[model samples]
Target: MKGVAESRDRSRSVLRIGGVSGGVFDRFRSIQDLAKDPSIHAVLFGDWISEISMTFRGNERASRTPDAEQVAFEMSFISALKPAIQDIAKNKQRVAVNAGSCDPEAMAKVVQQLVKDHGTDLKVSWVTGDDVTTQFKEMLKSGEKFPSLPSDTPIDQWGVEPVCAQAYLGGVGIAEALRHGADIVICGRVADAAPVVGAAMWFHNWGREDFTELAHALMAGHLLECSSYVTGGYYTGFKKELLQSRNCTNLGFPIGEIESNGEFVITKEKTAGGIVNVSTVTAQLLYEIQGPLYYNSDVTARLDGIHVADEGPDRVRVTGVVGLPPPPTTKIGITARGGWQAEVHFFLTGLDIAEKVELVKRQTLESMGEYQKEFTTLTFNVTGSVAENPKNQASATVDLRIFAQSKNPDIMSAGSHKGVAPDTPSFAKWVIENCLQGYPGGTPAMDLRQSTGKPFFEYWVALFPQNKINHEMHTFNGMTIPVPAPTVTAMYPRQQVSYDTSSPLPLDSWGPTVRAPLGHIVHGRSGDKSSDCNLGLFVRHADEWDWLRSLLSVGKLRELLEEEDTGKKIDRFEIPSLNAVHFLLRDHLDRGANSSSSYDILGKNVCEYIRYKKVDIPKVFYDRGTI
Candidate 1:
């Protein structure tokens, strides 16, 4: 295998980093910090949208109410300046961000509204014509049909919820956003490279036909997207304190200074308390990245052109990046409701029980025969209590999954306890989803996804064509309910309100300005039986604060808006940090360096040492302050 390594030379250098900071969206930070210095030429990458951001007006903070995503995005434009609107006023520079999440069309209008409110008659461009949710329709209309993500299997046998589907389009769509004389651009689901690509393309007036140069710029944007996470946040050597001063709080965002040749250095703010050495950058460069070679929504990059070296205490420069030609077909995400599915579990076991299992299942089926016929279909698969992932945990490899789905509600009532329980496994044990709350009756049929209902597959990246890229955001104006109401307590005199900060409510239960982790729902989803899944969350609140306090409190507010176990908090990581003790099985379970990523498929390097057994990763990232 090729060893983990990097090359340090004079040519590969980072003079500056282009970045958009703050929390969730770019609201938490201001470009003024970087603009004050001559190093940075532009600001980039602002994520707009979170429970509060899209619904409310800010990233969840300890002391916040909530606002709207549109408001948050508009506010970010101000932060990217010497003075509010000054950069755009002089036509000096600007930044691009995914200001909208699920709906781009609405995002356009939101910006248009903001501009109008500003009393400026800017000829805003509302770019549309792309929606992955209707990928099937687009393909049909274009006189072609193709499979969906990953394996892209024929849709004839699959049910796909076009929840989020769009190819990685460069910022070209925002071309119109710029051409209309709009200083700011808002897009949805554009590839991470799109903003940088769009800005460079429009800023330099590069044509769509220049594949080689655009590819280079696109590659640089890919390198800058994760900010510190790519730099020292996920460095390879933390033992020397690379992670010591890392302000999880200040967590520096990424910055890039692209040269005319397409090479760019990814770095962060000065005195930022994080390490930006070659090792740290090299690790970041390798993340989620496929090979020594680099790939982007636009082109395949020749990693060989890249270079790295220390320019100063915290600055590490990058240079030598080149890109190849683009692909042919476009990618799309079409959501035509997948069918319905309901599952009821029956816990049963015998010391020598494989034989008894068949008897019990057959008996249950006979009774539900009518319900089964009504539903149109029934499926029976078995495994372990850990019914989903088929990893190393197979000690008890016998479990059953009874699933059935149908278009009609009357037909869905088929798998009822009234239908399957009385028939077989008379002493049939435990059941969920079917026997609704103490009262055994038919439950509402849900679209139980095969990926979530069970542990199933491995992880892989699916790269699609670019023409399918759309950068539009839509806002569903509704009184979003809190996951679990933030148990409120008013502190009148001091102007304070206390929230549980651990709101334990499902995404659907979310209240205005509050949302569960991004793609959290996708965690429980099983891609296949053989893949081990790791779970984590990235929450985005769309709005920005007029003052500084808003950025400081998103984390606190998230906690406050949440109730105990009512929601997942960043503080859930307490086991090793809060104590000085180790458990009997600590060696086997810690996710650090030795223990497996429990269920992590993203390849997150969370734990330090377990299987090999140690409190710290021997040499990687460690606190130098302690030593």
Candidate 2:
């Protein structure tokens, strides 16, 4: 608690945001420990419903009546952090969050009740107007089309009903609310970095044109937006080394000490677990980024020129952030009712793993009979490996997974049509019917219920003009403010940059080499943007920069990907400052997290998967089995 107060300098401000929702807090320590510092100006929360959450909700078609259960689920942090709410009042610090997914007004009321229950009078406000389902529906009626950014596929081709849609709002509304004396601000779907941008602008009284400062604040927010991401939470690449430095079980969340000029040093609370350095900061900076140009509602932040340098123990100074005017349009997340999907996993152990998988697939289809035609899409994949002289049965086993989806619920629910078939229709039953008769050594990992068909949603992301949104800020007392439009207008391009085919190098120049995993010579991160996935690979040694740059070009990547490369567009960029190569795989994950059938919809494992790809590493970079 004492360290929290001293954690921030008076000139700058911000704390690691807990997460996208209060639900994330449940998995961590008590909220009181998070807000124990009095000197911290404000605590921000990003609770805006994510695209994945909306797909899971599936109740968008229901009446607009406020579902108490849903509200509690979204804003559960209010009750979860009741003590912290009291602490914010005691410290007279401000708090801003987009905890209200679709209903900011109701969320604001909940905050009011919580403040009253805590016996502390605090001013609160809510920002709204992100919802545009009505506007979208009207546009659709008038023949306006919304296309998926990754594939350019029109919404009509998705073959799903649009349920609910929300536009990504900016930090302007949050900043205006603070200017009107609101102690706590609640919002719907602002950008993930909006809270930090708003707080920094409020503290410095910065105008919209303060692009440079705003961009710096944007980076700070992006770094802390995922809470513990910058604090070794996702730094599991070198588990033994990272785990030794910090007990990741209770890893301290990141905190940004933004100086007056917008440059900030990312660090953790005193005596807290987790390490903060150039690598950790770099990992978070590259997380989920599309490219050098990062677009936000507030400003167009450029990241290609950014710099990260170690400054003392567990501290990294991040500077050189440049910004442009805000984009002319804001991105909108649209969710539609997709078909039903069902999947089952079978464990094939030891000998004849490949033969056993083929037998299982054959029997499964035979059992389905005519019912197999009901599915629109069906796929089978084998995971894990059977190695020579394996250590244990678990390691020797391979998991064969089957997935299927269909627009007709009945078709997906249909069971075995085989002789003396079970009474009701079910895909789970069909898969289980083969369990006893096929694949001599095949066994399902668990119960069949998990593989039952369930409804899924199609996610479509597009850009809509900012002027179209009817945004507003509701004050604590009884006033409303219309958010001003962006001073500088711009539009987001389809792609940030073209593929880098300029750098081509002979494959054999580096001398005696060993075929090994790329991870030993390079460390990097990967994440998803809609259906596209980006992998940013970097080498720590300066000497390896040229080799890495020349070696990881788009052509080299295609060679590495082998048959997995579907001939889709792959763009690569060079980040010389970090000696990193960034790649964006277009339309790689089906239709993104909501509808993608891949296990790794977010592409978090792309880097690890790529790292393990067979590569001829120069002998000099591969010393004693590691770089």
Predicted model with the maximum lDDT: 2
Q: What C-alpha lDDT values do all the predictions have?
A: 0.40, 0.76
Q: How many pairs of residues in model 2 come into backbone collision?
A: 4
What ranges in model 1 sit over 4 Å off? 1-17, 21-27, 30-41, 47-93, 115-126, 132-135, 138-145, 160-165, 175-180, 209-212, 236-243, 246-248, 291-297, 336-627
Question: Residue-wise lDDT of candidate 2 within 102-216, one digit each (tens)?
Answer: 6678778988988888898988899988888888888888887888877888888877788877888988898888777888898777887888888777766678878888899
Error of 2 at 61 (Å): 7.1
Q: So what's the TM-score on candidate 1?
A: 0.50
TM-score for each candidate, following the candidate numbering: 0.50, 0.91
